[model samples]
Target chain A: MKKAVPLYIGTAALCMVGFAYTLYQIFYVAPLAQAPLYYNQKIFYYHVPCAFMLFAAVITCGIASIKYLRKREERWDDVAFAAAEVAVMFGLIVLVTGVLWAKPAWDKWWVWDARLTSALLLWMTMLAYMLVRKYGGAGAERLAAGLGIFAMINIPLVYASTRLWKTNHPSANTVPSLDSSMRAALWLSVLLFTFFFILLLRLRIDAQRAERRLYRCREMALDAGLFE
Target chain B: MDFLQHVKTLAWKDIRVEFRSREIVYTMTFFAGMVVLLFSFAFLRESSAANGGMITDASLSPGFIWVAVLFSGTLGLSRTFDRERETGTMRGLLLSPMPRAAIFLGKAVGIFVMVLVVQAVVLPLVALFFDAPLFDHPLALLCLTLAGTLGFALVGSVFAAMLLKSGSREVLLPVVLYPILVPLFIAAIKGTATMMSGSMSETWFWIRFLLAYDLIFTVAALWTFEHLVIE
Candidate 1:
């Protein structure tokens, strides 16, 4: 715990630095957008990074959930819970930013395109995971673990199924075709978001750890007749 | 050999229990019928008003039919598991000398059949009410519904069992199942819509997707039930 403090602060400091630099590059270095989307297109840099991080968060939650289900360990559940909450934050940003970008780019506030719908459904499942964890009562942990795994498995299927709607959102490889300056800015933004993601995950895991420890203390105190 | 027989017997037990009262089937079909009726009430007039008679858009029937299938599917799934939890029979069934996967498979098979039975009423009703041609490719339609129903049942049975002991099972069941089953619903609806449009190749594509969904989730549900369930 003591050693982790410095690493946490260092990551936070590095992330701040990265964000400051990336924002400068995005605003100043990255060239003006093309005809249709001149100014608002900058949202793509933020939106794409958040979208990528959301995927990372979900996959992390799923892996941690598998471990928790297999071992029934408190630590694994903590990791899974932390990852899920982080996923929700990132997922929200992805959807909102994507929608904001869409209004200017696609001339629609929302599109029923494959990528958008899949992201929407995936975010909803993550929201359900949070709901079940909060309200599922006694066996909430097990139920949540099942949901986390199921959510991960549905990722590919959801994307594939919604593709039938004839997608208009930028394709997956659109990132590669961007101008060199904009692409560099986007990469820097992604790096900054990665740092931020790690900081949030670590903080949440620590909070969950503290919570379970307090719970154990209360149970032990009750057993010892200290409270009664 | 032994496993299949065990699964069959367990499924048979469920069917017999269901046949005795027929409460689940009757109410489920009725609920589905109401959904179909409501669809007609809501959209039939809109379409009729648009063109002044039954020039009902065929592309739209698939969405209505699937809504009914999914809604009634959730209604019956929780009730089916509630029956087990009410009498503590799930525990007994778990305790008996049979594989855990068998119980899961048997229960899924039972619900799969029930949802299919409900869909039987739903399809013709949607067609009759909406005046949409959903039966042009009979074989494709059959395969699509079967595959879609199979995916729905496999996922629904596991979730219904997971939420069995929870207090908010009624609300939580659909809250949990609908999002997870979105892919299945999309594929099924797409398949039906394509069939209505007389597109065999695309309809088969969606059917294949649904079949793959069933295969993956069937394994996932069995694994999850075995590990997640406790007496």
Candidate 2:
């Protein structure tokens, strides 16, 4: 087993259990009376958790960005890249699931409400960050780190725009606004998604390191004239 | 005294270079004109009550004008640094003695000035075509424009710097900037629109938002600029 096996196992186990419970809440255990409110669309349990995880991943990206800038460590860049990639994945999930929820709940596939628009903006920024990394070359680490910090700056903007503008977007909970049963279920979902994010990030980081190692090996072999 | 001299020299160099080419300003103004014209035709038809409402309402709703401005502003952004990269001059400037912050700020202020000039021309054209009265509070509107443009230029400059060396400079600049700029545009345009519509009572809040936007991004750009351009 690799050095990351324990973390992988722990996260996979936690996520599996949480995902199972989330499925139960969305499909089986959720009350039919509450269906009108969500209209058998309690899949928002999964959606909202993913949204939170997306935010958490972006924040971590920002932290890693700062670390890279301050320390100039390639590791921090690696971690930042991992977090940003995960944020993009989770952000895409939020967008898709939110659109899914919106179609049934709002009778429209998408609304230009502040929350949705801001979320879309965030998704665009994440995609841009990934692109910057893909093409940035020798300067990729620093360039992507700079963009990661810049992208994180959008989160607060997204939050504030929802408040300042007259959009139909739901205001983020000032405090977790769920009752006991709902809160327990919601927290579990969030925990599970966080674990999933961790697993994905670790896997991404490992792949990146492996890629880096292969490049270094190729460079060494070429220098040794192994091919010739 | 010497630091101020460096700032002035760099600003002048950028402006002078831009003048010699004038392509940046021309492209930006032309694009801004097209956008406003398109929106006018789309939303404000030749004759209708809806047109009348849109004309009167456009300035009142800063969202419309600011968005037009923001989208068009990207034209200036990609060109600002993209020109330098095209000519292979960005690295030469980076090798100069000017502080990176000064380079960042000077380029920003130059672009802000350029964008404001475009807005100055475009806003009146928008008003004339739509029959909207935009000069109701010219001074206050100017203040909002300056503050808003400064913030946009600040953030835009950093992204432009980062994208200058990237493959798809045009595509990447707006992708990184549009979302981060949402709040700045929202607050500034709201302030401008409100002032134009005789709603200056909310001036303080908008001013604060503008100032906050400028401060945060200026500090952020200054802090990270060295990391960005220093290789």
Candidate 3:
């Protein structure tokens, strides 16, 4: 883990550079969004990728959670916790950017559109997962693992709801018809966000692992009466 | 066969206890009725008094039944395991020969019945108060409520068991339960609304959705029971 510090620094630097390039591309290169949206539409590049990362993070948390429950492994719980925290951050980015773009394009900060509602529902579950971890007391980790599994089962329902109902948000096919330049910027943002998410997840897992080790060692010392 | 008996015996124990006291049944029924009553008070308009205080906000009529169910259902879920906790009977239950899944299913069955009983009174109260014909399509309404209540009970039982030993079970139950149960609520409320609107065919779709939700989570609750409920 110590040897990975330089690698972590290098990845952080790359993410910083990648984010800068993506911002530059968004402003100077990506073509103007259609009539009403204009420059305000630029949030789409960031918002869409963040939404993708949010889903990716949630799936990671779900899978790790299942593994943790099946094996009762602390590392799996660590990974699940890290992924869930990342999911929450990206969930916020998705909602905030989506809301910001809506203000300019849809003239409302919020709409009851199916897609928006779907995103909000998933985010709330993620938030609730964190709450259980924080205040659920002694067996909170196990309780959280159980929630992760249920949240995973709820995913298909969330996904299908948007399709089974009406949606005001741009439909799924909107991505395929994007102009080439905008598509380039969008893909680049997606790529950068993926790398950035993995680095953050890895760093968090390592930090949690370190924290667990310290706790264990302290407990051992207490048992041995090391303070005496 | 023995497993079935185990499940039955466990479920009967809870029913017999609650029925004898009539405490949970009475309190939950009252709470559910109050939910519907308050909703009417909030939404009813005095200007519609010309029609003898007709329900002016009928669009929400379908949701009122479920709102009552969801709220009182949470109340009942919080209390279902209280007796076990209070008497330290959970340890005895755990030590018994009954499989973990049996314990979960048994308790869930009891809670499901409790909710249905509450609904029996709450349903009439909602119809009389909200002025919706909840009983016009009795069979459809029954199927929707069964599926919804079953899903609610199964999920609620698992979490309630997990939080059984926690200090903050009451507050955390809804926070943890509602997000996961939102889909169930939507499907039930929508199905009720569809049935009340005289659309027989559309109501089936929501009924199927609720059943699917119930089926999937039943498996989930059973699977998680052994792992989650162990001391």
Please name the candidate that would achieve the greatest DockQ relative to the true structure: 1
Sorted by DockQ (best first), the order is 1, 3, 2
For model 3, how many clashes?
0
Better of 2 and 3 by lDDT: 3
Model 3 DockQ reads 0.75
Best by lDDT: 1
CAPRI category for model 2: medium
Q: Select the stronger candidate by TM-score from 2 and 3.
A: 3
Give the alpha carbon lDDT tens digit for every residue of A1-228 in model 3. Answer: 989999989989999999999998999998998889999889899999999998898889989988998999999999999998999999999999999988887789998777787788889999989999899898898898899889888988766644566657887788889988899999999999999999999999999999999999999999999965
Give the TM-scores of the predictions, in the order they appear. Answer: 0.97, 0.90, 0.97
- Per residue, candidate 1 scores C-alpha lDDT tens digits across A1-228 of 778999999999999888889889988999989989988988888999998899998989889988998898989999989999999998999999988989888889998998888778878988999999999988988999999999999999999888868778878788889999999999999988998998999999999998988999999999999997
Q: What is the lDDT of residue A225 in candidate 1?
A: 96
For model 1, fnat equals 0.81
Report the C-alpha displacement of residue B84, candidate 1, in angstroms: 0.6
lDDT of 1: 0.89
RMSD of candidate 3 to the truth, in angstroms, is 1.4
Interface RMSD list for the candidates: 0.7, 2.1, 1.2
- Per-candidate clashes come to 0, 1, 0
Deviation from native of the Cα of residue B6 in model 3, angstroms: 1.4
Clashing pairs in 3: none
